[model samples]
Target: MNGCLTDWPGFCRQLQYTGERRLLVLSGEESWAQQQAQALLALSAATSTLWLGDAPAGQPHSPTGKYHTALGREYQHLVFNAFSGLHPDALGASAGALTAGGVLLLLCPPLKLWPGFADPDLRRYVALPEQAAGLTSRFITRFIRIQQADRHVLSWQQGTPFPTLSLPAGTLWQGQQDNRGCLNPQQRHALAVMLHSARTHTPVVLTADRGRGKSSLLGRLAARLLRAGKRIVLTAPNPGAAAQAQAHCPVPLPFIAPDTLLKAPPPADLVLVDEAAAIPVPMLLTLARRHCCVFASTEHGYEGTGLGFALKFQPALAALHPHWRKLHMNMPARWSSTDPLEPLLFRLLALNASPPAPPPAGELNIQWISRQQLLNNDTLLLQVFGLLILAHYQTRPGDLRQLLDAPGMSLAVVFRQRTPVAAALLQREGALEQTLADAIWRGQRRPRGHLLPQSLAFHGGQAQACQFSYERIMRIVVHPDSQKTGIGSQLVHWLKHNTQADFLGTSFGASPDLLAFWHHNRFKLVRTGLAADGVSGLPAAMMLWPLTTAAQTVLPVWQGSFAADLQDEGRNMPGDLPHPVPRVNEQQDRQRAHDLAFYHRDWHADRPALRRFVHRQPPCPSLDEQQQRLLQAALIPGADPVVLAREFGHAGQKSVISALRRIMQCYF
Candidate 1:
């Protein structure tokens, strides 16, 4: 192949003739870059092509698709325009979409200054205007260096000759006759495992990097099972993920949402969960218990960290099904094993990254590192950020920008020698101006990034809390291997002792285990959102720890208000609502129980009693377990008497009413 701008057509022809994938790097003026891309697209005999980022006039293209949408799609050619700034995620995702005999063309500014150029995506990193310019990320710099060093990657400049093509030998792997539609040997093995597991009703887990054909394997397995008269239920975090498998299968496969499957499980011989790591572990556990299940997840996915899933979920699976089997697919289904972009993307996004090794069974050295220091140290940054990615279910590329550029954010990490075993990201909160604080309290204004202050003022009804300076623990993660070893507590204690903030607080989706962890750290639940979180489908809980007299003064008010709201909202809950905080004292519990019984029977007469019950705590003897159950059911704003009766082993609603009356007599 000739090496020049005009030679792109010849290069494309050679790539197509060989039936092998190649990456074309075009660097120069934007206009010339587009022209080169156009020439390649015209010459390449691709059935389908996608152009990401802006395209020249008369060019058919789609805007850059977010990395999460990469599943269930393939293309013969992909063009990524990096002039406006390179989106690491889009680059990673678009690379995976190319079929075995395809090409990925990346158009960027001159490679020398590409890293330092102002990126449109940088706007997401900084809050203040001054931090925008002269803010170059090292990740981009490293990416450019990698591109320059690789000889296999074809690079083209404006007036310079295009490098001669060094096409690798061998046609794209088309699977064996018995494994049609499977692109490679690894995928064929995975298909066999899945089919065998389905037939024997043995639980199986499929793990692979992105584009390993795990989803497609599931689809093929489902089709085979369905033909044999076995019902297959397919699910994922969303319908789009499930659709990936459905699209690949020749026959229609019954699909259900993750939550729906958990609530009312349909009859099936096998339940296949695609992107299983993205779905909550609790839901996955429920499905595993009810049906023979198969889970497919990317080993290091853009959607969620499979490392975290393996750490947390694998143990539960072991306990649930002792005979369960796991299969790992290593070969790429869409591209060759030697593709340079794979390693580049993994390092850039820390997709396959792991946290530092655990300390040698000893005390950890904790340190508070400034954001600038973290950014300057590439190895440390990866270790810290990788730990965070493994800890959270929804870490995205935007979070990396925030970590490097966001103001009022601080990082602390516990090191075992040179390895970071645990880390925390803290954000300064509260300290709002009086006007802004009052407006927030009155629901007239909302601010970005001030989660604690805004949530307290508006949601908890603590108007003055916005004025008090506080520290919000944004995220804290201990290495899975080192958890329950007190490293997390040590980090928290270090923050409290070192910082002069008036208080400390944190919030997260409420779960029994998570709530207990916060409570163990001495944080009191101050508020709980009525609506379940859109992502986790669980209610959010906010907890606070007072460190000063001023903070102490407001803590009780917030706690009391939260309790009252919980009493009112629990009734509408579908099932039993876990108490957000510790239960009240015996005296308060008795008074609350009495008021709830009266309110349940006749609210008009007991309205005044309810008011007194919330406002004051009086002296009284402790109530029995039955009395406590009555109080919980009756105080729940819309609790059904019949449901309460059944829950408490009563004969009927009449029996529940009689039991409530007996409990109320002592209070009266």
Candidate 2:
């Protein structure tokens, strides 16, 4: 006991000398762990310590483990009281907040109990009928295994003395001398590229790993632009993230949310977007199209992957701005390159995960990979996460936790020569009883997880839509090199045939290309949300493929009622929303559609069909400018002839009808 107490301070001094980050996990009773956490902080030479998680009352100022942004600040030590609850996102966010020579103290129960311990976060993605207790401990099991494998990790068991920690007084690392407006050569070169792009009015894509001073460099750029009296507008997923770049600026930089900025662009000589990957692609395009912009996103961190930015958004960006410049910062800004925590965090979270090598030229085979199998195999796990990151930049650490533990989540990967070429994440949903389905349909109860059924019941005007089971595709991704080769479509087809569900459905932020792809695969158009999705800043779309006879029979009724509801909210509708599907094989319906599309034949007779067809198909690209606007604006059921004429620059109501008729003829 005397020797252990003496060696505790010795470990702290070693950390200070080496400037290395360390992790100390206290696994015991809550009170014991809390006391241990405080004791370590007091013994260490840490000047600033941020305690995260629930403080045992009286310490009201102690930081709770909220999903706060840690970009603009640094702390010498951070105490994570996992005894209260483990927050994956909170942990990931604060990972970089600790500077070198700091310790991340985690307080939790013993390793054996951890796997079966019902974590608070397990309920986040688990929908109804899947309780947290029902979820496997696969995520926690892997987490424990990884930590146990790390010899450096300090572990403490309940009723047991603290594990003796030995520290080596390692040599310190030094970064390069300060260059023009940058701390290192990489930042300096990146700044020069930005300057050139600014002068040439070329768009810029700036990316770097976390702690690489990407935000710091942007701050320097912002300061320079401000000194020149240039108009600068800053934006990010949220104001908190933008503050990191603003920290380097001499003046307070105006920050706007990405969604708001897209809706109303401010005047600016240069627009700098921090954490660009968090914003949806549609909004990013709008910003890029309207201004000379620099989009800076992190390559990897606790937050998520910016590698997906390269795989998904870059191609679209190239199409719009061919002259866009790319810059990457290579060196760490605050911590040493030899920081152990950096690599450990990457390994623990799979933040540095990379996809499989180029697929061999062989037949593709689709197979389901279980969560337990993924937990057991590191290579399989990395490849799965890598593909997820490549497909969705918003793939965060929390998602990794959910992937291994959340109930009803299944993965299907298309393999070629034993390497993943395409992958799909599917979640079982719906299967609601009639009583609950009725309540949902009537707007009395709104449950989580069963997104498709809930949308169908509430928005699609059919309570029976919730009676059937559905396997919903959460995400689908094909290798960047293998994309556009029908691999994605093939995977979807395979899922549809192999899955034993009443229907195979999907919900996503709708885009023209995406909608077309699903439509081509025989999925019918359903509901397009009335409000823009918080994540994508685009309207959500629901589409379904019926596998059973009952699903087919009920779908037709859903189409009519949902179509009526959508037309009621047409003023706020997105351009991507095609009109609802018109009932097929009805003579009156065909006549109405023909009359409305060809020449606004009889406004009274074709009102229903016209409304359905107009909202059913996407905007006509082949139509001339005036004709397209005319079709877009005035052809709806309740469109006012005079208002339509003045708004769309059309001749008159009669002329509007005549033009719509010609337009409908092409479409019909």
Candidate 3:
């Protein structure tokens, strides 16, 4: 287009002829990149094109379709500018929108210097405003290496000649077109599997990368099932994802959100779950147990990777239905298998990333590693980041930038040989000036990256806590295979003993098992957020471990305030109830048994005249083990009465109910 690369038309033609997607990297000055993109657009034969980032005026540009909005959309060609800093989520998402024989033209700085260049997105992860100016990331360096290894990627500099296009050897179309309108063999196979599942009342799992037509296959299967006189229900994390599958079905099909479906199910012959990974594992398990369901999810998606779903939910599904079948769609519905952009996106986002194989069975070595050291070692960085990704649901490209560039952040790892089996991310907090501390205490200022101090001063009413230095353990991850082996606890112990901070603290979505783990580490609950977290739909609990005498002086005040707040909130509820006891392990269970035995003995002697005591009562502290078991079974949601009877050696549901009533009478 700029007269330095005249083979552009020929290269585009070859890509279309082979039905392959190719990446055209226009790397040079901003003007050069824009000029090449404009020229390519004029010469190419793409029918539908979408421009991302800042592009030439009068072009079909997507204003809001940067990273996450590209799903459920399709295009024949795309031109993405990385001048504003490359967003990995945007790049991965837009690449999936390209049709077969399309071209993804990327505009960026020269490949060799791109990694070291200042990225604008680094500002979002900078610990301090001063650190934003001199930040760099190893993620970009690794991304450049991946691009260099891909031969199909065409790079254009200031004055280089356009390279000749070389196509990979393979027939793009693998099988004859079926009457069901499937474009490829993979889609055909998926359709057949869905049909069989509907007829046999078996659950099926469908997994594929984006743009694999899995959504469309689901729609066709729904239509076929409906025509066969079967009622079908479609669901997803959001209504829009479910709509993708429903759009292809001719007949009306009801779509429900995953949570609603789990809470109250309607009559249906089969249930189709789209984007299964985005739905919580608990909800998916409920659907699997209650209905014959077909689950469809992208292998690695911008919404989030399905690796966790495969690791945690698949076993549960198998336990519920051993005959369930799995189908994988390997062929891309919109592009060729050899598309260089696919693998590049995968590596850049660490979407398909898995932790390093567990260190050869032995004792793990735990130590703190500097950010510079991690940047210097590519293998170690990948292993550490991969474990972090697996440990949390919200890990993203921005986190990688922080891991490398944040000045106040540090990493600790437990290694087996050279492989990282467990890791923790810690951030320094507090040490705020008097002015800033006063503002935080008054809820006038809330700064980024200082979660522990700000939360304690404003929410927990511990303004003095903000004056002392602290370290917040942001995340602690142990390899799935190494869990329950004390790796996580050992990591926390190492941090507490090694650091000079006045306190060690953490905040996370509350759950029984997680609370037990923190309690066992000697961390006491100090505060709970008023609102539930959007992701887990559960309240967040903040726990603290005092490291100095100054911190110990303020601990009792915070604890008393937290306890009062918990009681007040419970009283405000409709039932004027008390909060449930935190579920800890065998020691607490035994204590509860002892307390309940005392309550049973005193109930008749100390019986109160007012019924108010019965209505506002907390769990019976003196119940026996059997009574506690019966109460738990009756009160917990989804607990089957028949199963409880069998498990607890009761005669039947009648005996189980009788025991539960007797326990309730003692409390009343």
Candidate 4:
């Protein structure tokens, strides 16, 4: 354990021979771990090494908080100091950067006591009132168990030397460059598909697991287009994600943010979107319209595993562009396919969590499962967590921790022949004391774990709202393969009869289709954010189902108040001063509306008249649900045709406008 630890160099040589990576776990005190890491660093002979903790003053280090910066950058050795904090995201992202012939040095407490130690990272996610006092983390227990059993993982004890290496044989295919510089036929095929899309203005979605060269292929395609004297723009979730693409491209390509591209799309023959999954799907749909582009994303691992891009964007992509192409790069450019670390990382992070084979067509089983049960059952835990991951864009390992350890957490999973198909994460809140309710209503106090009641009292102007108990549906997700099968609605229907809280409710980023789903499930809207949220760019809507008569009577009054005030308008309308809209003359307004709706086609010209036109009864037959959705979206303050098109199953903005015109024509 002393000296230069000469075995380190030989260990790395073994990795190079096999074309694989290793996970080096240094378990013991921080002092002992740091010494071992320093000695290994001196002898590892790696050109590129990264430190993920408090390093010797001058080493290349990555703070756990900024794990994102390490992504898209390769290193031969990564020294992760778990004593600082065992951040699942940072660990996963950092591990990814460990290319073939690399080792991830995870320094932590001795295996036996590691789980009991208070992880600093947990403090960020383990919310207040959710004490971690007696809770045992199943995630850490499973992680350690796997590490000990794996031949690839070398667990070095405090006083002992590094474990003997048994490097598995893995293949390393040298990519021979063609005229286009493709490494293999698979990559060449992908590049050709992208080229065709660029030429014909067809949309393309390219997916891959981590370490696959999707980003590199994108760069090669960009270079090829540049050779053809084509205008190309590259964009990603952030700059770091675009590094690999930029580094591979000899020609300098301009990088754009997704938001900027959405607001003002640059004129380009092609737009290359790297890390497409990290960006919201709504934005992706808008970008899909702007240019013939290749949207490349990691199919799993780190921030992209939610399958949000695939589940939400691809289906819509197919509908919008029937000729849209799909390509998945299976060959790993950075490591061999049989790399032990890769598969281990996948299971450790639950990156590969997916529904098992679909159960035979039959009745589904819905059952309540406790967090304690989740802690002990690995199969159930992964299925439940994975379903949540598939349904959301921001699902992370911290969420898994919260689900397992947080107070008031409950789970309802739907199974078909023992295979999990859907899951709902529920939390209980509200029923505050009179004094605390008054304080929350007066903005004097903010209690933890009561989002519904706090919103109702603090913003909804309902003083007694906090006194009513609530069961909140934190998250609900149905398997992607089995969706539109009424499984999600079934889960909601089950909750209606099961909950005893005064109010059963949920909060979410509002979309037309999402709102309609809630409405269909008997939830009434109680609060609406006036403006779109800055980060998500989606309006916030809260809906509640009243379980008691008192809640039933109070919720409607709160909705009326919300309707009148237009709450988020407070930024512009300061001092809570009411600015009433003037009434339009009925006869003249009707005539003006007629011109706007049927002939003029300018709803903006006579605003009051257009409002009356939209709100008043139509001369023609009743509007269907589809027509109603179109009208609602059209009336919203800043409805974009691109967004409306995606929401309403239209192919493009022009199609959305045509639909709106038809809906308005009904008024005439």
Best by TM-score: 2
Overall lDDT per candidate, in order of appearance: 0.71, 0.74, 0.72, 0.75
Query: For every model shown, what is its TM-score relative to the native structure?
Result: 0.75, 0.80, 0.76, 0.78
lDDT of 4 at 304: 45
| Candidates sorted on TM-score, descending | 2, 4, 3, 1
CA deviation > 4 Å runs, candidate 4: 2-4, 129-135, 167-179, 262-266, 361-365, 431-449, 463-468, 478-490, 533-538, 548-553, 566-668
Clashing pairs for predicted structure model 2, backbone only: 578-615, 579-615, 579-616, 597-661, 597-664, 598-661, 598-662, 599-661
Task: State the displacement of the C-alpha of residue 331, model 1, in Å, after optimal TM-score superposition.
Answer: 1.8
Tens digit of per-residue lDDT, candidate 1, span 1-668: 23343555555555544445666789888889998888778766567887887889988766664545555567788888877556665676667667655777888888777766776666555433455588766556656665667665678887787676654655544433354577777777778877888778789988987767888888888888888999889998777777768987899998899888878888888999998887776678788899999988877655654344676567788899988999998877665565556676666566655676776686678988876676577688778888988666667654665676566778888988768999989888888889877666655666666788887766554557788887888899999898888888888888878877888889888877777788877887777676666445568888888888988887876676556555544423222334444233435334434534543333222222343463454433567876776755665555677988888888997887777666655556
RMSD of each: 9.4, 9.6, 12.2, 12.1
Q: Which candidate ranks first by lDDT, i.e. highest?
A: 4
Q: Which stretches of candidate 3 lie over 4 Å from their true place?
A: 4-6, 63-66, 111-113, 116-118, 127-131, 159-176, 183-186, 200-203, 229-271, 279-293, 304-326, 433-446, 571-668
Q: Against the correct fold, how does model 2 do in TM-score?
A: 0.80
RMSD in angstroms, candidate 1? 9.4
Q: Candidate 3 residues 147-242, lDDT tens each?
A: 778776778776676555665555644423468968787788788878987889999999888988888788889889899899899998776677
Cα displacement (Å) at residue 358, model 2: 4.5
Task: Write down the lDDT that model 3 would get.
Answer: 0.72
